[model samples]
Target: MRFSTLKSVYQCKCPRCHQGDMFLRGKLLNPAQFSVMNKNCSNCGQSFEPEPGYYFGAMFISYGINTALFIAAWVALSVIYPDYSLKLLLALLGLTVLIFLPFIYRVSRSIWISIFVRYKDEDLPSSA
Candidate 1:
């Protein structure tokens, strides 16, 4: 069985063909185009934007991801350093979230799109 859908999400590939990259190639630290995406899948001609305001849903996904990351960080820090102050823990969490914001933004959009799109085996041959 093809796990291309799962692979696509993690790799940030096109959902239809799992070949074309979802976002444009650029330095991860380049905030200018970090979340910039191709209008269509280069391999399958699948449109990235199905409708206007489509990516608005991705904000929810991003929020959930950040929340989970925060909780995990807090729990791990508490366990590793039992005497750490709340202020310090919050500061660390803030820094961590800020540093990973761009990554999380791209990932959340990839995940959101994958939820509504599925890989088609027929698109595979044409993609190649």
Candidate 2:
């Protein structure tokens, strides 16, 4: 319904309330493994995964966020960690991001979709 509400979903916390785990996988998603979300929240009974590809948009959102964060982290580390070599810092950030790449991708998509979901309010039970 609001940007703040949507961001909470992007945080990979509960989409319904932002207070619970959005993911049952301990805040991660496996593209190859395909972790499925319950159609509705266990706590609130509100729909979480609304439809197929509902999370695809979050991919674009995630890419933008991750890229920006990486760049910022690079700048911050370069300035703050004066002793560390630039190459080393880059390498470490690269490896860390790479390790969590799948999760980032999934989360970005999930959050992006969640924004629209708030506006659409398509949680009503399907008539079909």
Highest-scoring model, TM-score: 1
Of candidate 1, the 10-residue stretch with the lowest lDDT total is: 119-128
Candidate 1 segments whose C-alpha is farther than 4 A from its true place? 124-128
Candidate 2, residue 111: how far the Cα is off, in Å: 2.3
Summing lDDT over every window of 10 consecutive residues in candidate 2, give the lowest-scoring window: 119-128
* Candidate 2 lDDT over residue span 1-128, tens digit each: 57767566656555655554555565354555434555665655656667776776666787787887788778887798868886888797897687778677657756665655443234345922
Per-prediction TM-score to the true structure, in the order listed:
0.87, 0.58
Q: What lDDT is obtained when candidate 2 is compared to the true structure?
A: 0.64
- Cα-based lDDT for every prediction: 0.86, 0.64
- Candidate 2: clashing pairs of residues: 58-108, 58-109, 59-109
lDDT of 1 by residue, 93-128 (tens): 999898989899988899889888887877545657
